[model samples]
Target: MGQRLSGGSQLLITAFVHFQSSFIFIFQDYLEENSTSIYHDTVSIGGGSVFPQIQPQSRPRTESLDLNPESSLIVEISGAVSDKDRVLFTIHTKTTLPEFKHTECTVKRMHEEFIWLHNYLVEHDQYAGYIVPPVPPKPDFDASRAKLQRLGESEGSMPKEDLQKMKAELEAFRSLFLQTPKIWADSSEYLATFKKTVAMHEVFLQRLAAHPALRHDHNFRVFLEYEDELSVRTKTRKEKAADFFKSVSKTADEALRLTNQRDEDQFFREEKCLLTSYHAAVKDATAAADLANLQRKTMAENLLRVNLVLDNLVPKERLCTSEADLVSVLSSFFEGYQKIQVRLASDEDLKFSDTLRYYASDAGAAKDLLYRRSRALADYEAANRALDKARAKMKDIQAAEDAQFAANDRFKTISECARLELEDFKVRRIKYFQKNLVDFAELQVKHAKAHIDLVKSTLDRLRDIQPASSSSVMKEPTDSVGVPATERTVSLDDAFGSAVPFL
Candidate 1:
């Protein structure tokens, strides 16, 4: 780290840096060039996009995962100052639910780190362009250590009480980490700013790797000086270049594969096919129900006419037998027709038709999933390749150099695992859709058959019934009950329509 300075001293440094910048036209031009380069690098490296990597397939969720701030886990701390002005806090983690998992770890506040980061951001306003996340005031470590000494733990060894206290502090830190979203719940500006800072940093790294002038710049060196770990184990330009090249190659390959996968995806088209089939089925079912209802109404009307003819017009006539039989058959057919309508109304297939339409939208989502999965796979491959190149480069270098790229290998491993998990999810999703499609087809067949049976039975009943005697049915009745003179026979063209579409 650089020399720690008071607020006034840091202001003086910023002023001086600003003045130096004003005198350098060449550096100003370089900054402009670097800004444009940043956009290109952020979007793509070696003709392949890298950032905003694809994620794995998320499980279908019926409810949101957002946590209520008031209901979330929280860490509460109460502090008291010692004679040395050291703040010691008694901390504990509390959750809304008893079932919430808990683990404790060592907790050390980032008092010094906060100061350094704050001062750096304030001084380099053009570079940071964002505020640091809120950090708690520094606690007095000296006072805390003194209290620990008084607890009878000698030679830097910790007593059980001290260890327990440390555990509580660790738990507090962990709780705080988990509660970040809640802590910054009011505004997302912080996150946007954070992204900007990261992008800025990434741009700077790429510039440093590409341009020697930037590597030697006083301001650049000062900006990098805080990264003490990097200084401890450094890689040569050649090794860095090798890693970058390997990453670019992997990213390009992954992007290509993703594009191919997207183009080859049949889910969207299949979903459309399914929707069209379902739409046609719904129409057919609706038409069947309409026809049945019409037949029932028509039969009821005919029964009324027959009743009028038998009760008053032909009460003691032989035509009574034929009229009574007609009434019986019509009533039976109407009852059966009503049942068919009822079944059609409550049909699971009809209900499932809506569900099919609902899930038809999933095909679109599935396409998106494939896209995301492809991107994620590419990211994982790129990370893995970069790590591999780093490791290979380290093999020929000192152990210190190996330490510089050790984290790369870990990151790459995690990415690779994530990609594989996403791939597994896709496979599972495919199976799920396959089963759903089969079930839908079977149900559709069953429903179509029900409609066919209803129509067939109805036609058979109509054919079996005939006017008892043509002259008896046609002759006018003179009784008080008046029957309509219009013919009661159903027209095949009007009722059944040409061929029973489905039948």
Candidate 2:
């Protein structure tokens, strides 16, 4: 692995050097071009273009460390209340910072409010160098609700026991839907949506709190410390259209910038390539994980159907006593098995699959940071060219110099901050994966143990059952008809192996 990484690094360096040399020659040719033509064709400093001009801030002498020994901001989604189509999250903020109105406070925020905050951060020029956390997706329970409706429509055909057990499980889920109104309390769909949205929101807030600079943002403070509704409204059609076009322009600019520019910083160059590969790999992993979870749910549903069939069969008056007894045992076994399968699927989705999905978004955010820096670099180069043109033409020399200096300062600041942010990202990403993977493994072990116990108890119950007649009782099968006695016996290792083959 070390050798491979070293070789990749060498290739990257070689390519960068080659590109740099090629750019120098191309730039010399452009410089040699008639200054009059260049001056006439070049856009004015304030002219609208693909790359927006950024106003420079006073450059900091030293990069601020993402650490606070004296005080730390802690934020959490304490509870959530669900309205008809909206959820109000109770954001609890605790800190010792004097900047806040109170050291501790709680505020209610809706999903739209979260969107407002995320957009505020993204649009703010001050945060251009930072990897702003991705906006939490709007909570949508339409699919879950549709599934519930289907389940209700089919309830009559489903066995009474299975229906009751499923309802009971949903009710248990409702208990986790903290402070939800009675109207939405009984809804499995609402419960799931509430839990998922709350988790995403919590992660967003936690990330902001942990960031040294973002935690101090005035808008973030208001979001956490203010008690009333933020009164944020949805964007109008015109605004949405504008944003759409802006995003399209940005996409185009990113591709152009990447093609034309070679990152002078080796660290950023390697990070750019690493992030691209990581994002692709994570995306593929997420799809596979989702597919596996879907298959598990389907398996559970099929098991439930079989359990229902066995249950219906056991009650038939025509069936013999021994046959009914056998059907009853099988039905009971399947009931337990299906529940275990359902729980296992949910666990995997929450712990493993969601983690991968979240990191993929995070990786994208990191890549965006790189793109911003690249855009800054492009701007700096453009400013330098304009300055040279101004000097050659002896026109607006002071204005051109100011623009060049501002661009240079902005580029340096962004590059410095970006390096620190990416390093922190690497550490945080590793820690997050380790913790979640460990928790997932532990949960798998717990579920597998439960599964084995269920099988063992079912087997014991089957052995205790007596035949109703001689015809119903069969002698032990010979080696030719079935597995020999030694082969039939399963050790603990075999049980575990059978229960969780992936593990």
Candidate 3:
């Protein structure tokens, strides 16, 4: 009778495990399909923007999207050093191109220099059709320094282990930020700033390098290969004011065009609407990801505090043997859990949040391309009207005709370039989001498995110390479905569901 009952129980557990696995698989499929469906539905609504939707069966192309694949120019931020109030970046360049003075060279540049390069690209009339990469943000470490200061102020009441951990982090920061080691100071802030800025600058240079026309730009070549400073000056107050008003005028023009003008081309019309919605969605996702990361960091800190308390309790000589063992195990568990949480948070920030933020900015650039095209269209129409009036008046007819012809050429050129840029933007966005999302999902699964293992091991240790009841010995930890936690496995497919398509 006992044997039969045990066999029956085993069968029931096996069936339950299968059911649970099926449920998870079904849920994952639902999420993948539902997300895609929602995006398509949202994009299908009437708007000026147009984007080609990725078919369910179609795979994103994996070929090099670079227009100038043969270009041998390489640029990198090799290192950076902080002066009293300024940070200077060492831009290392290597090229086999004849345009450069040398095959390899390095030059120091500041944040303002990077801005100068971006502004030059933006204002140049010849490159107006191209989607200029967004400017890299200025590196700021104020928040990091403030956090370190707060940590220092609380040092008197903090546990020794926590204090030591913070010091170790600071040391790591110092090593990353400076060529020479310095005393422990605002390491987290500086390290974060360095990583963010380097990533942004690298993306900016890579974008410029990949462009067929921009790569050959004389100013860009000088920026990369020139050994001396570019000697770009900061904008004067008058210039700044002019720039502000120019931006305001442009915004007003965009709004007016959005209301009055409708794109005749179906492709461009969908692209404009699609890009605007996509950018807003990406921006929201980035914010949510950042908030989640912040919460995880806070949780890790709390876990550290709990671990410290347990560490202190474990050393108490008055505690019983079982109590001491339990305390020690708890401390070890929390410490490991805290470390895993920190690592998980960092992975998500780097792979998910940062990727979303970057694409958000890039999407904005794409939108700007649409805006510029629209503006060119408006100019062409205005020129046509002016020509019509001149023909009616029979005065300055030759000049009016020339103006109309010029506007027509400019509009056609911008339209063609904008189409190519938008297509490339689509391909690049998909490639990046696919890679980053898959990596993030895999990391999440790996961390989750680690968490389960930690809990299972901790429970086993605790069970061994606990006094046995008359009923039975402690059994191995099992998940909700009654499957052993140690036996549970998550495959990449199960975790990632399917390839996510981006707008």
Candidate 4:
């Protein structure tokens, strides 16, 4: 506690003041307590304002009314620091003495030194002894609860036989795990080779699929061959699996890949073949369409020739017909060329997906399909034949119509020729038989005129004689008059073979 003596000085304005040697706590409790709270307020002594009241302390230590020579003053002090260690300092408040404040003095202001110096509860010589840092505890490893659980109930004790048996089992398991290294190595090598083979198979299938000819073949034949080869391979599980209680470690997808290897490959191959054939078929059909048009043009030309010949008076004939001759007449595209082409395509007998099917089943199916195709082709050929016959019949009808036209033309020509001849005969008859001979000559002219009529009638009769067959082929030959060449001359036989007495 800081010592102070308060007394009234009555004799003179000057009074004796004594500084106390007690331990002075240097920090202002009011300043320190309010150091963090209210700041110190300085007011002029002449101004007559008490420092805004610091919270009242427990009791007043001393009181004095000093109206001395210098000033009137009241000092209040509180602190926890021991004053013996610091030179006592004071701030002059209630006066115009700002220079008296401790903070007003600036020396070397080492920022933390002053506050920390104030924190000592006692002098450094009074501090007891050296402080030691606390040590952290060591961690336990073997004693871990997890290790105890791993040891199981056997941690405390176990029967020897059971112990022996477990030891033996562990030894046996370790041996078993190690025993097949050679076999495993061989299998590993085999698997490596198998992987390469599989890679080749995949590449081949990919190439086959990419082939322009094989895209749509649903069976994928080239891929199927790889599958067939895979099926023939060793499929037995590894011997190591028997020793292991662990269920086969292979996943379902791996097992399936191994198992269906051959089957998948087989399907791909068959489909490829079918796709190739279909590509070829499409190419063929286009060319066939063009050929068909050209044939129709030829047939039109031949028919036009027959039309022009009959326009004149010359008789149209099917001379020297033969049933077996090669006429070089073109086929209608569908019947002649296309039918042959479709047959060629059929003969390829390409087995696509169905080739992978059961042999008897595939054969039976093929046979049935073949039968249908053959029957259809046959029916088409028969229709083609019927069409050919109808076309030939048309020609015969046309020829007959042509012959009638020819006959009409001949009749007109013959009548015109006869009329002109008779006109000439009349002139001659009148001149040669001067009335006497005219009658005989006129009768001769009538006879000759009658013969001409008979010749025309014979020709008209021949034109009306329809042939038994209208085929382009016939062994018999006919002349331009449509009479058989070897036929007895109709005019000679009917008109002049014998002349009887006139009726």
lDDT (Cα, 0-100) at 279 in candidate 2: 98
Question: Which portions of model 1 miss their true places by more than 4 Å?
Answer: 1-359, 370-467, 473-503
Q: Give the Cα-based TM-score of candidate 2 against the true structure.
A: 0.74
- Candidate achieving the largest lDDT: 2
Q: After superposition, how far is residue 128 of candidate 2 from its true place, in Å?
A: 0.8
Q: For residues 76-108, could you state the per-residue lDDT of candidate 1 as single tens digits?
A: 222121224422222333334333334321122
lDDT, model 4, position 118: 19
Q: Which pairs clash in model 3?
A: 48-269, 49-269, 49-270, 49-271, 49-272, 49-273, 50-269, 50-270, 50-271, 50-272
- Per-residue alpha-carbon lDDT of candidate 2 for residues 1-503, written as tens digits (9 for 90 to 100): 11112334333322322233244345445545732242354454677443322332332211112223244677777777667678778887778888988988988899999999999998898998999988897888665456457668979897676676566546544465444443222233335445667777888887787788898999999999988898999999999999999989989987775656877788988998899999999999999999998899789878978777666554444343444555577679898998788777777887788889999999999998998899899999999999999999999999999999999999999998999999999988888898678667666666766776786676555555543321111223346666643423323233222221110
Candidate 2 vs 4: which has more lDDT: 2
Q: What is candidate 4's local distance difference test score?
A: 0.28
Provide the lowest-lDDT 10-residue window in model 4: 12-21
Q: Write the per-residue lDDT of candidate 3 for residues 265-349, one digit (tens) a residue.
A: 9999899889989999999999999999899989987887877766655444544444355557767889889878877877777
Q: Which lDDT value does model 4 have at 162?
A: 45
How many residue pairs clash (N, CA or C atoms closer than 3 angstroms) in each of the candidate models, in the order given? Answer: 1, 0, 10, 26
Error of 2 at 157 (Å): 9.3
- TM-score ranking, high to low: 2, 3, 1, 4
Off by over 4 Å in 3: 1-71, 82-84, 148-171, 174-193, 314-320, 456-503
Worst lDDT 10-window in candidate 2: 59-68
**Per-residue C-alpha lDDT of model 4 across residues 263-376, encoded as one tens digit per residue:** 223322343344346435534543453355335434433443332322221113323321101111111111233222222222111111111121222222222222222233
CA-lDDT, candidates in order: 0.37, 0.71, 0.70, 0.28
